[model samples]
Target: MRALHAPTRRRAVLIVPGFEERKITKALAAGADEVVIDLEDAVAVDSKAKARALVVRVLRELDRDPARSIAVRVNGLATQWAADDLAALAEVSALDSVVLPKVEAAADLVRARELLGRHPATLQALIETPRGVQDIDEICRTTAPLAAVVIGYADLGAALGRGAELPPQRWAAIQDRVLLAARASGVAAIDGPHLGIADNADFRGRVHWAREAGFDGKWVLHPGQIDTTAAEFTPNPAAVEAARRVLAALDEAAERGLGVARLGDQMLDEAVAVAARRVLTQTEGN
Candidate 1:
């Protein structure tokens, strides 16, 4: 199990409906770290087969880029279309991963792997229900090519009887738990999309909260949300410079056989150095 890191500067993820060809192309070039071609919620009941075929065709035709991830969100395991979706995707060499929606336990991942056969595409678990959230630790710990565990707020909120509209703070505790599990498992923890097209202020606030809550990235439904999401998740230039200075000071002190150092009014130790290093790491290749 290798540690999964954000692939793009924005650390933004965009999900394009599999049935929408134009949207797929737009998402791929939209500066998102990952673009998930959705075959689940975005497609209608009668369009599953057509969407799967279209997604496969699009994937086969697209140029593969190692720097960015291109994944497909197949329908839930229990759905009739999942098996066919997995089978069709098993041989798509251009795909980076498979987004498994509505995962409830470790068994769900196991079943998906079984269905996926020997395909090397990694798995991103979409935890949408109460059971999925409760068993998130186990899901994250599963040994199957797991890359990230994303929280799906729409279905989750509905399952929790919270209705369609949910405040960002309402998800704080759940976000913390998912982040904790992903950290322990050495995988990326992704926050779900805001599920709204308008209300730019509200969207920015939600993105800010996710960044502050320590999420590796966020799912953006529309391309317009990409820049804001990326900007908010990205560390400020001043902060990155400050972190570099702190690291430089700490490294110099260590070379002098000192375990601690002083930078202005702040005492720098291994703990402070650790935080600075994280900030610098986030800015890598920016």
Candidate 2:
């Protein structure tokens, strides 16, 4: 099996594990940066083994391209299927990562790594519980080989009992905490799916809010969401150009022994430089 690595693109979509080959193909063609074949909530209890076998076959077929970032969202540690799911996937060279759902503590990550047993597949934790949110900082610090972390808003909302009608500010606060934790740990921070699959305006609004909150990306639930999320996460051309100009201006100032520089009416400092570099990094190879 090839070594595991981080995904290059921003948008990631979750596909049920038992999807037909053609459906999987169409999803990949829909412009998702990463495709996660879900084995947890998406699969029926009795169909776990079958879904696992199908996922393995699909991953082997998809991994040949090398450019495709394919992941599997295995059942949580509390489930009977979680061990078998990891064991089965450990031998697949094409698997880039495993999404471990309901990660509430650092020990869960440790157990997952041990189950993976030297395989190159990275782990992306799904933070869905109140304990997971509270211990997020410690989880981030202790977990090794963690590629990214994503909010599982549906489960989290249920656990918190905020209901479907919770205020927007409440959700924003939760997302901000997850984002801060991921950023502090120097890993990708992905926002949860919007859940309003057919609501383009709602999707765009949520995507914009996530982008503005400094999230790396958002989960896409449908093929229709793929293009919209991908576009939303990608830095705009004007922003990219402005970032380049900031770098250039900083370089010129350094050459002239200036401690500070001005870009229009705004002053350029380390913070501005950092933001500009982030823009360039995000837009690389676009």
Candidate 3:
């Protein structure tokens, strides 16, 4: 039977090259809540077998708890390697999720479901093409076993040609579609990666943009990106303290049988109290 998808647990996910288990191990130790060992574009066509073997080995060693997420990004159904890839993945109990790259329709997920059988791992989609974006709604709403919808910035921009920037406005339609799909279906909508590998300032700006756009978090390539993404996505101490104050004042007011209250110069409402709780909850896994 199908199962509930694993929840997105971390403030950030580090996307590491699957063939390099060393890098994967380093990233995991470097504060990534999880790592996406990529076996597709990151691995050369000839090294697919090696990458799979490494990912499986890595999976065998890591904790698979939802709280300590570890996922694998495999080649799509169109490739000769996908079936074998799924077969290998099906054996690992340490896998929290399986990322399906370049999914264009629900049929991709159907094939994935058929392949996963009773393994019960969640499906995370990497939206890397216009077609994938066009069909993203049905993909996100297809029911359990599906988790987050991740944007694939580099590949998507390449797919759309030279005019498309890293975080292309050209694909805004698909971006909104993925967001609506994820939000409507109660899943996290993760933003794609930033190609500015060495520019910390630019990367932070891009991540802030993703947060503003309502993305859950970013898929990062470098370990340097993780702390920045996590810091940006998670509520800071000031915000958390403010939230705590809002809730505390409201609780005291309620205890005294007061229907409304004001915290300092600001008038507090149920909305403010809830916002405080939300800020705290957002850091649950951080």
Among all candidates shown, the one with the greatest TM-score? 2
Per-residue lDDT of 92-174 in model 1, one digit per residue for the tens?
A: 87777889999989888888888888777789999899999999899999978788899999899999988545778888889
lDDT of candidate 2 at residue 263, scale 0 to 100: 84
How do the residues 28-114 of candidate 2 rate in per-residue lDDT, one tens digit apiece?
666677778788988889888888888778766763444557788999999999999999999888788889999998888889989
The runs of at least 3 residues in candidate 1 whose Cα sits more than 4 Å from the true structure, single-residue gaps closed, are 1-10, 242-278
Candidate models: Cα lDDT each:
0.84, 0.79, 0.78
Cα shift from native, residue 280, model 3 (Å): 4.1
- Worst 10-residue lDDT window for candidate 1 reads 1-10
Q: Write the per-residue lDDT of candidate 3 for residues 26-119, one digit (tens) a residue.
A: 8667676667888898899999998899888887777544455778889988999998898999888777788998988877887886787778
The order of the candidates by lDDT, greatest first, is 1, 2, 3
**How many residue pairs clash per model?**
0, 0, 0
- The TM-score values for the models, in the order shown, are 0.85, 0.87, 0.81
